[model samples]
Structure formats: C-alpha cells, structure tokens
Target: MYISLNEILKNSIFKSVTILAGEAGLNRKVKRISVFDCPCNKDILNRNTLINGDLFITCLEQFQDNKDGIYDYINALIMTKSSGLLIVTDDCIDTITKDIIKICDESDFPLILIKEDVPYAVIMDTVNQYIAIENLNAINTLKLDKIMYGSVSNNEKMEILYSINPNIGQYLRTIYVDGGFDSAIEELKTHILYLNSRDDIFVRSNNYYIFILSADDIKYLKHHSDATALKVKEFINNPKVGYSRIYSRKDISKALEEGKRSLETAKTMNMSFQEYNPLSVMQLLVSVKDTQEAHDFYEAYVNAIRDNVSAENLKEILLTMEIYVANSGDYKATGKIMNQHENTIRYRVNKVKGALNMETDNIKFNETIAIAVKLRILMNEIFY
Candidate 1:
C-alpha cells in the first residue's frame, strides 16, 4: 500500500543523488520521512527517535565532529527497522567513507548521498508527495474494492463509484495481470494507456495486478485486443493476462470471475493472454477438466475419432489436424503451415471426420471438433 524507496528514488529530483550502498533493499517501503537536524548519537537513535519504515533525510551536520557516528546511525536504523538514509552532504561532511558503505551494504540499509545544493524542501516535497498520492490511491482502491468484492448493496456501490468517477457509465471492464507488485497502483497512473482523467482503480491483491477500466477506456481494447496486449506486454513483461468483457456494475463479481477463469485457462493452455467469452470453446475446455470429465470427453470425441489411427503417423496426423482446426478448418492453409500438399491435409482431415461419421460442410461440425481438438491437446492425447 506504501510507495517503496525504489519507486521514489526514480524521481528526477533524486536523479542527481548517488546510491552508495544497499541497492538490494531499495524495495523497502517508506511510511514517513525523518530529517535529521538534531545531533545523531546512540542516545538520540534510541526507540523514541524513529519508528519502522522511516526514511531519514539529513544534512550530516551532526556527524561533522565525529563522522563515524554514521555507523551508529546505520546500526540504529537496522535495529529499529527504518527504511533508509538520504544524507545531504555539507562542507563539514562532504562524502561518506567506504567503511560506512560496507556497513550499509552488509546490514541491507540503503545509504544515499546528495549534493548540498538540492534543497531539502524539494526532496521532501517530491518524496512525500509520491508517498501521499500512492497512499491515497491505495485507500481509494481499497474502498472501491470493498464495494466491488464485499457484500455492499448496489445503491451504495454505485454512489461510491460515482463519487470517484462521475462518468462511470453503465459498463465497466477489468484487466487482471499475474505480475505481482507492491506499488502497482501507480501502474494505472503511469501507463499511457490509462488516464488520470479516467479514474482507473488498480490494486495488488493475492499477488496479482487487478485494475478496473471505465467503459470509455474499454473502447481502445474491445476489438483491438492484440494492440492492447502488445502495450500491456510492453509495460508488464508479457504477463499472463485475463481481461473481462464489458459488463454492468452489478456484474462486477462475474467480471472479476471471468478474468480469473480466463487467466486460469490461459495458464492451462500455455498462452500469455486470454479474453473471456462465456460461450468460448476455451470456456468449455476449462469447465470439464475436473475429476474424470476430461478423460471421458477425450475418449468420447478425440479417442473415438482417434480410433484406427496408426501409432507411427499419429504425431503427424494429430499435428496436421490441430493446424487445420486452428486455421478454421482450412485444409489448404493447414497444409501450407505443415508444408504438405493440400490433398494430403484434406485426406487426413477427412479421415478423422469420417471416423466420427461427420462431414466437413456442417457448421456445428467445426465447433464440435474444435472442442475435441483442444480437449485432445489439454488431455495430452498425443506426445507433442
């Protein structure tokens, strides 16, 4: 829910700052900023001076007389579970020694040095503002989350949602990413595809990035899924994504469920992304996998069609059949992909259909076999 030091240090204001040590602990969350104006010593670093998750910003004036006080300060930071230290160097203490950097690295306490010219007010403003906005987004996301996933009445949910985005139309859509992160709320904020004007709600829950986009924003993605997917992968590292169809506010639970189920389907199918369709063949493929149902369906459709098949040509025949089905029953294209003659592919396609006592011309035949082909793959009927 809090912004990590790693996130804040990315600001342009911190670009001039040097990260001296403890690069590994950059993900530590910053709950507050502590500016050290008072003398820093063991007595001052006691429990009363700081709490957990405090990031200390100091001028290093206190340590000018005894610069090794940096060691005691760092040890105190580790003991109290503080976030890290940002030292603004002055004339008296213009740089940190290697020994202190080693201590910071060993203790996993971030040590930073900044120019004395960079105003503390600017640093505090930049870091604290990031903290504030991130905290606010987290709060709003949680509130809407309760209204969405919790058992709140429809009127109340609508009212709260209206408060956040007055233009929240009849429809809302969700995108779920399996990329877990601490400060994902900013993902919605920073992405070019998402607009602050749109009031998108993003949150990290159960190690997944869940965000709800308004119907207006869904316009960009409804039919341009590939483009949207490319953009998501561009930013999100090709994560396993399940995006829901546009649905009403009352269908929030169903929308989230569709996203979850579609993501599951993508994982089971070894795909990077899936868009949920209630009547999709993928939906049917996912539904019947529990217990002995997959085996039963495979036996009735795939194995039945698979009967009288030779063990030697089984791999080729199954591969050709899969290509044919994926190409929408186009034997010619399937042949091109398989680098075989169209006649050969058509014969293999008919041989499978003829065994099932069906013809290629029937509309439902393609749908039926599509399910069977996917089920065959899902059940691992063939070695490949």
Candidate 2:
C-alpha cells in the first residue's frame, strides 16, 4: 500500500493515528507512505525512505513542491502498472489542495475522506476491499486519451459539417449555362449537381456556370481525383467518374489569381464589372473548409519539396519579389528592400529561374510558383 498523508500536522495527529491504526492491524499491509505538506528534513529522508516492506514517507509542503514528487510517485505506480490505492488528506483544503482535488478528479485518483467516527482500521479495510475489487472508473477515462488522439478521418468529415450548421457547409441548387465546352461542362456540372443532391453534398453545374454547396465538399471531390484516376486506370472507369489531374489548392489559387488579375485589369479599363480576387477567394475558402484543405495541401507540398529545395532560397525570392511586384518591376525599390544593387537583384532573379528550370524567361511560371509557395503558408494555417 503506497499511501500519501499530505496533512499539515501528520507528525502529531496523523502519525499517532497511523501508529494506532497499524497496532490494530490496519496498516499491517502498508509497504510505502508519502508525507506531503510537511516541513523539509534531510534526516527524515535517510530514516523513512523505504526499500521494501519498510514504510516509506515523502513530505511535500507546497503545491509546487508536491507536483514533481507526486508526479514521480504516480508515474512510478503507472510504470509498475499496478492496481494501487492513493489516499490524500489535508487538515485545511486551500487553493493548493483544491487544485490537487481538481487533478484527482481529472485523473481518477482513488480518494477517501477522513471523517469523524470513521475508524482508521475501518478505512484501511475499506481501501483493501476497494483495491481487491479493482475499481477502474478512472482507468476507463484514461483510455479515452488514446481515443481522443490524432486527426479526424474521412468518416469524421461529415461529423464536422453537421457539428456546425447542418445546412451551412452543404447546399442544393440548379442552374443553366451557355458557353465553350458546353456539353462536356454540362455533364460535369450535372454530375456534381447529382452528387450534391445527396444530404452529404450539394452542387449546381451548367454550361459556363458552376456552384458547390460547401467548400469542404469541393475539397473532398478534389481529393477523390487521385482515387478516381486509380479506379479509371485499373478498372476503365467511365466519364461519370473521371478524375481531373489538378491539385485542388493549386487550381483554386490559380483561379483566384486569374480573378484578381481580371478585377485589376477591369480597374485599369475603368470597367464597373469584375470577378473575384485572391483575397476574396481566400475569404470564401475560409468560410467553406475553414483552412483544413489549405493546411493539408501545405503540409503535403512542403514535405514533398523540402528534400529538394532549401527554405532560404525560397525566402530570398519571396523577399525580392515583394518589392519587384509591388513596384511593378521597379528596380530601385526592389533593390532597396533586398539591400542589394538593382543589378544584383536582377541577377538573383535570373538565378532563381535557372534553379527552378524555367525556360524562355517565363516570369509567369515564376509567379505561378511564387503563388504556390504563398498558398502553402496559407494551407499550413488550415492543415497542420
């Protein structure tokens, strides 16, 4: 029996009661004891620290003092993996003791209160009986820690949706469209719409128009691309289940850039009409998937490229590009931000293209990759 008596006066009242209890064959089975909330004494350590059947006692005065020592004793019990009883009693239950009680509540530490007329022998017998029965309500709760660990699986996807607003992350609607790839696009739209018709999802696809109930649904659909591709290659899956070879985040980011560019160009032309911008799409994206998709994409992409690319190299380009793109290729400001000669920055840009294996001096490709990098950071916020 490894019992800890954390009483302020364990020396006087506590020890006398314990000795009497032991004489009455109450603590006869006791192996170790801990004395908490007592004044420190090095002599006490040498005399009372038991090795085997000898009674071992540790005195901890303050809550912080008890923490490490108590944790060690608990961990020792856990390591041994034994069915043991831990008893904690104090003369005055202060904030520290209250906190200790909270820990006990959370941890399922077997607790017994010392009350008037409750003989120590009876208490000891009761504890022995409880131990024999192996009361494990706390152990059951401990098992829940494992169950609560890690990320949610595909089965949990719908759990998240319904956990929020039942109708929020999904929608059901129909629309018409007229434009290029009309028939193929219509089929794709119809397919998405049909998929969304289920309670799990919602879709609206027609001609040049496309709409989805939830961003999560779109992400899920996009993830299915790899699965769809595998199924098609192995089983000759039909167009109804065709998979696009597009990474969802990449495609979304590109579309966002296109939208922003369109809006900016519209502004240049003094046009009232405009499409969505990257920032607007970002807002919409957050509203739907709430960053989960972005995080997943970032983690995957970063892990994929980290082996080949140095973070420093990417950072350098990003820093220089900030000024260059801001000033619309103005060398002076770009160089100033980089703290390098304008020519040096140009040289570095050329070097970046070489490193990335970009041909024909395609700055658009560089820009695309830059956007991808930024998207990675955005995705990390959602995923990992």
User: In each prediction, how many residue pairs overlap at the backbone (N, C-alpha, C within less than 3 A)?
Assistant: 0, 7
**Candidate 1 off by > 4 Å:** 41-49, 159-279, 283-307, 336-343, 350-365, 375-383
All candidates: TM-score? 0.71, 0.24
In lDDT terms, how accurate is model 1? Answer: 0.71
lDDT of 2 by residue, 1-384 (tens): 132222211322233332211122222233333333344344434564423322222213343434445544433432332222323343322322454444444543333333233344544443333332222222322222222342555345334434322543332211112123223223333444434453322212221222222234555654442343233223221212211122232132233234334433333334433333345543244333335665564455444434444776655655565466556667777898778899988876565555555646687645644454455433333321
Highest lDDT against the true fold, candidate: 1
List pairs with backbone clashes in candidate 2: 35-58, 35-59, 37-60, 291-382, 294-379, 295-379, 295-383
Shift of residue 273 alpha carbon in model 1, Å:
9.7
Query: C-alpha displacement of 368 in model 2, angstroms?
Result: 1.1
